[model samples]
Target: MKLNKTLSLAVVAGAMMVYSCGGSGSKTETTTSTPAPAPAKEMTPEEKHKDNPDFVNGLALVKQSDCPSCHMVDRKIVGPSYGDVSEKYEITDENVERLASHVINGNVGVWGEIPMPAHPALSKEDAELMVKYVLLLKK
Candidate 1:
C-alpha cells in the first residue's frame, strides 16, 4: 500500500510538472514592435540636437513636452523618429515653415493613419525650433 501511494504521488507530481512547464515544441512569440524603416544612426549629443538655440530649446522642450510620449529623437515609437522625418523632408526654410504648420495643425497622411495630434500648447516659434532639432538628425 505504501509503495502504491508513493508511486501515485510521484506520478501526480510528474504530471503537474509537465503540465506547469511549457508543452513540448512550443513556438517562440514574435515581438510586436515594428522596427524603424530607415537605417538611421543615433547621433551624439553635440550632433543630434545641433548647436541651434532652437535645437537646444527643442531638446529641452521635448523632454518636458508631450513629444517623448510617442516619439524618440532617433528611433520610432508610435510615430516616425526625427531621423526618419529628416530623411524624408528637405530641411529648407520653406520646409521648416511647412513642417511647423504640420506640427501645429497635426497631419495624418505623412507618417500613417495613426495621426499626429495637434499641439495647441506649442507656439509657432516653438514648433519651428522643434522642427529644427528634428531636421538636424538628417542622415
Candidate 2:
C-alpha cells in the first residue's frame, strides 16, 4: 500500500510538472508581424512624358535649337526657365499651342526688357512639341 501511494504521488507530481512547465506533448505558440509599406515614387520628365512621342521629339529638338542658349530647365539664364513658364500658365492644349506660337513668333515685355527671338525655321508641329516639353518642366 505504501509503495502504491508513493508511485501515485510521483505520477501526480510528474503530471503537474508537465502541465505547468509545458512539456513536449504541449503545443507551442506562434506569432506573425506585418511589414512596413513601400515609399511613393517621384516622376521624372522622362517618366511623365514616356507615352507621348511629341515629348521625345521636343527633347531632341531643344538640343538642336538655340533654345538652350537663352532658356534653362530649372532656373533663369537669359530668358525665364522652362519651370517659370510652366508656373505662369495652366497646361491646356490651347496654352501649349499659344506658347508654341510665342516661341516661333517671339515676344518682348512679357518676361522683361530682353526679347525672345523667333524660331521662323521651326515647323508649327515641332514648335508645339517644344512647348509641350517646356510645359512639363514644372517644379
Candidate 3:
C-alpha cells in the first residue's frame, strides 16, 4: 500500500510539473506594446510652397534647364541670384510676362554687361513658370 501511494504521488507531481510548463503541445502567446512614432519636423518656406502648382512645376522646369549653371537661390554666381531678381521685380502679371519674354528672347544691360542667354527653345508658358519660381525666392 505504501509503495502504491508513493508511486501515485510521484505520478501526480510529474503531471502537475508538465502541465505548468505547457508541455501539452499547446501554444502560449504573450503580447507586447510598440512605441509611438515621433512628430514630423517643421518645413521651410520652400517646402511649404511645395503644394503650390506653380512652385512645383516651375522648380521642376528650372531643375531640368541650365539655370543652375549661372543662377542660384541665395548667392550670386555667374549671374544675379534668384533672390536678388525676386527682390528687384515685384510678383505682378506684367513683370511675369516681361521676365518670360526676356528669358526667351534674351536681355542685355539688365543685371550687367553679362547678357542673359536666350532660351529660344523654351516655350513662353514654360518660361513664365520658370520666372514665377525665381520670383518666389524673395528673402
Candidate 4:
C-alpha cells in the first residue's frame, strides 16, 4: 500500500512538472496582441506636388546630379536652400529660362561669394525641369 501511494504521488508530480513546463508532445499555438499604429501625417504642399510629372522628373534629375551636395529643400548648405531660391524667384518663363541658364553656365555673387558650379552636361530642358522642381518647394 505504501509503495503504491508513493508511486502514485511520483506519477502525479511528474505529470504536473511536464504539464507546467509545456513539455507535452502536443503542440500549442499562442497569439500576442499589439496596438495598431497611428495614422500617417498629412503631406505638405511640396510633398503633395511630388506626384506631379514635372516635379517627379525634376526631382529625379536633381537626385541624379550633385545638387544635394550644395543645396537642400528647406535649409542652406553650401548654397541657399531651394525654398529660399523659390521664394526669391517667381515662377515665370523669364525666371525659368534665366535660372536654367545659370544652372548650366554657373552663377556667382548672386547668392553670395560662394559660386554655383556649372552643370554643362545638363541640357536646357533638363536644367529647366530641375529649376521648376526647386521653385515648387516654396512654402
Ranking by TM-score: 2, 3, 4, 1
Q: Could you tally the backbone clashes for each prediction?
A: 0, 0, 0, 0
lDDT of 4 by residue, 1-118 (tens): 9999999999999999998888776978789989899899877755789678878899999999999999988899999999999999998989999999999999999999999999
Tens digit of lDDT per residue, candidate 2, span 21-138? Answer: 8777668778998888878888887898888887788888998999999888887999999889988988799998888888899988889999889888889999998888888766
The weakest ten consecutive residues by lDDT in model 4 span: 42-51
Error of 3 at 129 (Å): 0.4
lDDT of 1 by residue, 1-139 (tens): 9999999999999988876775464756577988779987777755754657877887777677888888886789999988888888887999999998988988898888899989877899889888877887676
Query: Considering summed lDDT, which 10 consecutive residues are worst modelled in model 2?
Result: 20-29
**lDDT, residue 87, candidate 1:** 88
Q: What is the TM-score of each candidate against the true structure?
A: 0.63, 0.69, 0.67, 0.67
lDDT against the true structure, per candidate, is 0.82, 0.87, 0.91, 0.92
- Residues 31-114 of candidate 3 have per-residue lDDT tens digits of 998888888887764887888888889999999999999999888998999989999999899999999999999998888999
Q: Best candidate per TM-score, number?
A: 2
Between the candidate structures 1 and 2, which one is better when assessed by lDDT?
A: 2
Ranked by lDDT, the better of candidates 2 and 4 is: 4
Which of the predicted structures, 1 or 3, would earn the higher TM-score when compared with the native?
Answer: 3
